[model samples]
Target: MGTFRDAMSYPLLRVGLIMLILALLISIAGFYRVNKTYSASGTLGEGMHYLGDDKFENEYLYHNRTLVLYSSNANLSLLQGAEMTNYTLVDREITLHPEERPVIYVFNGSVNYTYNATAVDYPYAVYSLFAFVLMLVGVVMAFLGYTQFLRDVKEGKK
Candidate 1:
């Protein structure tokens, strides 16, 4: 296709593709990492997303320099550290046991170490980060190419 062929000519397009793949990988790794660290093994059913709707059916991945998962059960509260620490309940929801009060705890830790992903999919943060970087690169490359093309044209006239 002409569109596809045209896209391949630009280095920005290539970089964009690479960034896309990297973002996906990071998201997967983030989910896996969250699952591993999270004792709440209960299937979130349709993963996690910013908008807790069908449109956002995906795995939940903690983000930020630090994450906090609220829970009272000693095991659930502890992620990296075992010692009992002060935790506050941010939110609550339904679980397997109806009678069981939804537990919550502050799971504070570095996302980098906690998540198995290069960049935890914290709100699709990974994709956004890479996309921004790719955009910056693309701008620079376009400017360079345009300037060079203009220079070449001027030289030919002389």
Candidate 2:
């Protein structure tokens, strides 16, 4: 405990604590942004086409009706539990029937596809989780540093 107190008295330790707080705030913001992007849904089709955000590398398409070919730049991969299709990708679009398959599109860059189906964006979810872990570590470090600093101040008065 004494050694920790001595180490926390340094000016660098205070700076580290401040940085940790900032990290926590940033992680929270990131989580909110991910949820917002994923929850927002709109129509994409002949009349109303949906354009993918440049920041996102993947999007999920969900529905239980007709399957239609829409234009997109991303590679479509059927997610697990989704109906398998032998449809070929041609002219940047492929038509599926019965809408029984849930497809997840993977893109090297950003993508813009017709959005006749519900879209779920989660390209940044992993990044958000990573940030959350970092924030947790930062909080623990800051708490220890602050506690030691307080102890040192009390001892100095004695």
Report the poorest 10 consecutive residues by lDDT, candidate 2: 39-48
lDDT of each: 0.36, 0.46
TM-score list, all predictions: 0.26, 0.39
- The most accurate candidate by TM-score is 2
**Model 1, position 101: C-alpha lDDT score:** 19
True-structure lDDT of candidate 2: 0.46
- For candidate 1, what is the TM-score? 0.26
Write the residue-wise lDDT of candidate 1 on 44-77 in tens digits. Answer: 1111212112222224333222232323222223
lDDT of 2 by residue, 34-126 (tens): 222222233332222233342331444333233444333333444334454333344465544333334544433232333333344444456
Assess the local accuracy of residue 79 in candidate 2 as a C-alpha lDDT between 0 and 100: 37
